[model samples]
Target: MAAADPPSPTGMGFFGMLSFRRSATAVASFDPAQEDELLALHALHAHVADRLEALSSHAQPQGPVLSLPFLSKLLDAVLSSSDAFRAVLALAPVAAAVSRPPADRLAADLLDRSIKMLDVLNAASLTLASLRGAHRAALTAASCLLAPALHRAHFARARRAIARIFPDDAKAGATAPSPSSRTMRALSVSVSKNWSAGRHMNAMAAHLAPPPQVPAAAAAGAGCGLGLALYTMSSVLVFAMWALVAAVPCQDRASAAISPPVAPPKQAQWAVPMSSLQDRIAEEWRRREKKGSSSGSAATAGLLAEMQAVERAARDLNSLLEEIAEEEEDEQAAVAIVSEERTREVTEQAEELAAACRALEDGLAPLERQVRAVFHRVVACRAEVVRCMEHVPRTASSNAAASASGVPPPQHHSF
Candidate 1:
């Protein structure tokens, strides 16, 4: 061969050959499809790290840990990850089709669980309503005429009304605080009064459970990669939902048990960040739970910054009221002068609470919309999977489920 290729620099050289062997080994171990799927999974993991983990730093740098912008982007990441995961599943090997019995059951369970999140969404919306009520109470109190400008009697009455609305639920059967307006009255029913955040989230956790582990023998067969991918994606979904519930306010809120489901096979690239996210959230939750417990409140605090803002504003305003509302009148004049300093303090807190309310509500509107979108997306994905995996006719209950979830039956299965 003319002694020509004396250790050519390309593939024939020592280093080149070593690289080639490594490449060949990788190729032999994973077909291009599996390799691509793995890259996609890595991307998903990195996204969680990049988007979700980044929030921890921003929690202090920007403002509140769960600021409005943070929440908006958090939901965006959730939706984006869902879509990306579904894309991966859509492109899985055709051989994966026959072996999807495990995934089939998984998809069905996920679909059912997604519906249960509606109740969570409803509960969150109710919490938002309660926030609005608190905001209204702040406004009513702020408008009260203090010492000089208006009658002390008027200020006293306002204080009493708002106080009625502000009692912690630890006091049983507390009525909604009467507001100055009918709308205000309606807003005062704190979800914390009757709703149990712990119970609702526990129900959500029920749906977040991991699918049964596939037997090793079966997993070694044709669709092993797809099965792993499904389980991995399911773990991501479970953690995301549990995290969302943690961020919202709820009563008797116990952290959802997610260790089993959130933990993927060891050494997984995604597992690190997933576990990190879980740990941070759980830590924050424990902190909040401890704080609420120490404070003797019936409902536990939430992870949201705005939630804290709401509480602070309410507490400060109420403190001011205790000093002014319970005051023994001088009885020298009909007009009680509200010192400008006192008025300023009350106004500041009112505006602060109002601003916080707007931000929280603004954040919540998109969050709820995204939750609904998630619900429908899961429904559609499940429908597609059912069509692809099972040739059997659709049963009445399945059709009803599809109907109830608001995603029409798939007209045709193209994937």
Candidate 2:
């Protein structure tokens, strides 16, 4: 034996000690540029964490009511956090390139957390816009109350002007002239020299007319009989045509009456409960961290999975809102042309969209809660990591000093 080498500092075996030494050497040998980059990344993480905490504080409410002031503050916080988050995302690839495995995993987790926070912020923004729109609509409706009176005044003015143009006869005492009298008066005023000339020509022609070949009485009797026969034939034809029309069914009406009814669309369902998934992810992280495994990687994966689920729910909600918007546009365009029959259809569609919005909101509530809880947890974890990182260098320096002074290194708990 080569003078039984002094027991390794790690105390596991030669191999374990060698591994520890190698790791320490690698950390010590990190390029100055890489170290600077890592520090910058970590600082960015701290900034983002602070922003998140501020946002959460502003968003947190003890009661159901969300005041306008609170919402405004929350919006501001979210906007600031979003700006910091974007900066972090932009530097993520660079951070990944220079960071160790644990740090890399942490960066990824922070990215996921930031994305989820953004999703929550977006949903809140949409809700705020909707509330503002409804408020404006209520104000507009209130303003419309004055319209009817204005319209009445306008109509009265128009009626007065018309009465002046075509005044009613006071001497008539509400008894208007008959249609025959009016027509006769108009005809008398329209008569001219042409009418008198035509009447004189007709009298001259009748006086000089040739006599009929047959007796007048026989001719009259024959004419009457012919006219009676023609009348009877016309009456029979009219009755037959009416009966034919009544007996035949219309093809279009029959087809419409027998058309099949359309089936309603299926309602959407969420497969995973967001709250339960969040709990599972947090528990798994805790268990993995205790076991000394790569808990960061595991935790990041869980967060990603949860984030995807949340994104899906948010996407569905956005799609539903888009559909509602389209329906509203259609309703508005049709307002001028809408008939009594179509009004009911439009109303029914409005009700359906309202119901859909309510359902979407109900579904999003749980997801929002889950996101908030995860955000809080992630922020706490980040704080701990930052604290540990700050302590590590100080502890390492103290240990080196102790070793140089022939004193034992101070024992410390592993992170």
TM-scores of the models, in the given order? 0.68, 0.25
Cα error, candidate 1, residue 296 (Å): 2.2
Once superposed on the true structure, which residue ranges of model 1 sit more than 4 Å away at CA?
A: 1-49, 61-64, 92-105, 143-154, 157-161, 164-174, 177-220, 250-261, 298-301, 329-334, 391-415
Candidate that scores best on lDDT? 1
Task: Give per-residue CA lDDT, model 1, range 1-415, as digits (tens).
Answer: 5533223223232212323333443555555555555455455555655665555544554333455566666667666766766665665343244235555555555555555454455555555445566655655655553223544565565565455545653135546644333332221233445565556556544544333433322333343334444555556556655666677654444545423336554345455556665666666666667777787754434577766766666566666756765553443334466666766665666566567656656666576566557656666665655555654333345667899999786432111
Q: Assess the local accuracy of residue 132 in candidate 1 as a C-alpha lDDT between 0 and 100.
A: 60
RMSD of 1: 9.8
Q: What is the lDDT of residue 290 in candidate 1?
A: 75
Top TM-score model? 1
Candidate 2, clashing residue pairs? none
Indicate the residue-level lDDT of 334 in model 1: 45
- Least lDDT summed over 10 consecutive residues: which range in candidate 1? 7-16
